[model samples]
Target chain A: MTRLELLAPMTGRVVPMEEVPDPVFSEKMLGDGLAIEPSEGLAVAPMAGSLVVFHSAGHAFAIEGPESVSVLVHLGLETVSLKGAGFERLAEVGDTVAAGQPIVKMDLAAIAAAGLRSISPIVLPQLDEGWRISKTNAATVQAGRDVLITIER
Target chain B: MQVKAQAYLEALGGPANIKDIEGCITRLRMTLIDPSKIDVRKLQAAGMVGRPMIIGKGVQVVVGTYAELIGAEINKILKQK
Candidate 1:
């Protein structure tokens, strides 16, 4: 069995996935993971892998890391309606990235001004059978520096 | 995956019931002509992870990262009709 570690995509208070406003995320519909009420505007690669999915609206992105574990970082709640207005993409889809590398930058103030919540959900999207995940107990975490999730197979 | 898409389409009340469908990273969001026509049981059988969230005329199906592919497939089926 092997284990994979995922770092926080942005600095923020780590909250249980259930705390995310979206039912899809809060209910773990997509997969099990956590959310971060980001205090910083920058989002980084949680682990080294190919940048697989980068939403055109800039509200979300996913990275496929080792052990075939894919981590999705969704920027905010209902921010997709903003249509990329408060986001800047620093990396393109298919780009090979390293852990902690900056992939996107957000204008948190703009999101707030638009009356959107900036609570970002970090999701597994898909969890294969036999794989288990654990989250950090820390109330807050630093982007790319703190471990957010650990997966074991 | 195409088969799953077809199942998802049927679960969403088929092409005639769909007004628009788009995929975000984790879910397929659709606007349906008749939200009441959606078959929640079929959606769960077709691999939908969570309950189909229906808000007014809009419905969101959480299909993980395959959301885009499934959305495109459903759109293709819609186009063919």
Candidate 2:
């Protein structure tokens, strides 16, 4: 299995990600990835890959890149209803992205007053492979921070 | 806050049984292990209150916050075999 390099969604605090179970771990609990306080200002690529699973709402996307890595980004609550009204899609499906590449942007505060969460989740689907991947601290991250998640096969 | 849900990767007869696992508008869409071990009643019991929905060929659990944790645990459990 090839190693998939993952990156932190934001330069936020790198605390130990809790191992939650059942109803507590669902998307609904986070209120559509809220508390992370999303923004219409900008949602950049945490890594390079095919931009798959861009919700019609334009608030979320699932990116697939090298090593079969899948990264899902949910922008805000019900922001999908905006229907791409606020966010600007920087790239199209199957397009390759690089670390720190700009994908979308908008106002952060405005997104929350509207009643939504900003907690973004960076996930790895094929994380089951027998490889060694290490993640850094989930500190308050910026777009271009060197938050490397290297998976060694 | 607090959450709970039932997770399965082995019930599908190991990860080999699943073609893919993804989430949608509400439910976590899963391509299953023969779709035989997918007992809605049993899955629901594991989830406490949230019921399981058969969306298309995928058997889904209404995992809220427990979604990620359940997923994490499933991944760990599956990797052990």
Candidate 3:
């Protein structure tokens, strides 16, 4: 089976989702993946796909690609209350995005001042049967450069 | 001081209007019974930083870092009745 690699959507330190703190994500209720303690203010598309779900708040988004693989990019822990103050949307729903294309711009300083952690969780919500997902061991990842997820179908 | 989650919930038309609640690092994501019921003035008064967004069947409220705590509180309220 050929392995499909999903690159990092943002630059940050990659941590296991189990460290996310929020039970929903930590327990893999939303799906299994890794989290990033982001250092930059921008998030890009990890893979070329069409945006299936785009929140107006720019806090979270879900993209669906071929082979029934869907990925969710959630910014911060509880930043939904920031109400898009520090977030900027670069793409809209149904837009076709290329891998490494900027999709959201954020003010990390502003988010920190608001007392929100800028830890982002990138999850694969749609894992079909017989598909295996694995995480890369890279401690720090660069957007469009490092492959954080490897999938074998 | 930022508005308490309880106050925000009250201004959001109570738990009855809430269909579901989820939180990310900086926001309180919710599914509301009626998006029109949201009072922007009250939300701002309660210390929300930005405008609310209605996405599909859900609404997202920017709650900063305390979003998870607030989410937990909301869940507690939901369980009560």
TM-score of chain A of each: 0.98, 0.70, 0.97
Clash statistics: count for each candidate:
0, 54, 20
Residue lDDT tens for model 2, A1-153: 565555544444332323212232342332222123332356677777877656544566667777665666655544544555666677666677786677666456756666655455454443444766576544454555555466667
Model 3 lDDT tens row, A5-65: 7889989999999999865568665568999999998999988888876766788887787
| Candidate 1 whole-model C-alpha lDDT, 0 to 1 | 0.90
lDDT of every predicted structure (CA atoms): 0.90, 0.52, 0.81
Count of backbone collisions within predicted model 3? 20
lDDT per residue, candidate 1, A59-140, as tens digits? Answer: 8999998878899999999887898899999999999999999999999999999999999999997778898888899999
Docking class of 3: incorrect
- Top candidate (TM-score): 1
Residue B62 lDDT in candidate 2:
53
Off by over 4 Å in 3: B1-81
Prediction 1 TM-score vs. true: 0.91
Q: Candidate 2: misplaced stretches above 4 Å?
A: A1-3, A11-40, A77-85, B1-81
TM-score each candidate: 0.91, 0.55, 0.68
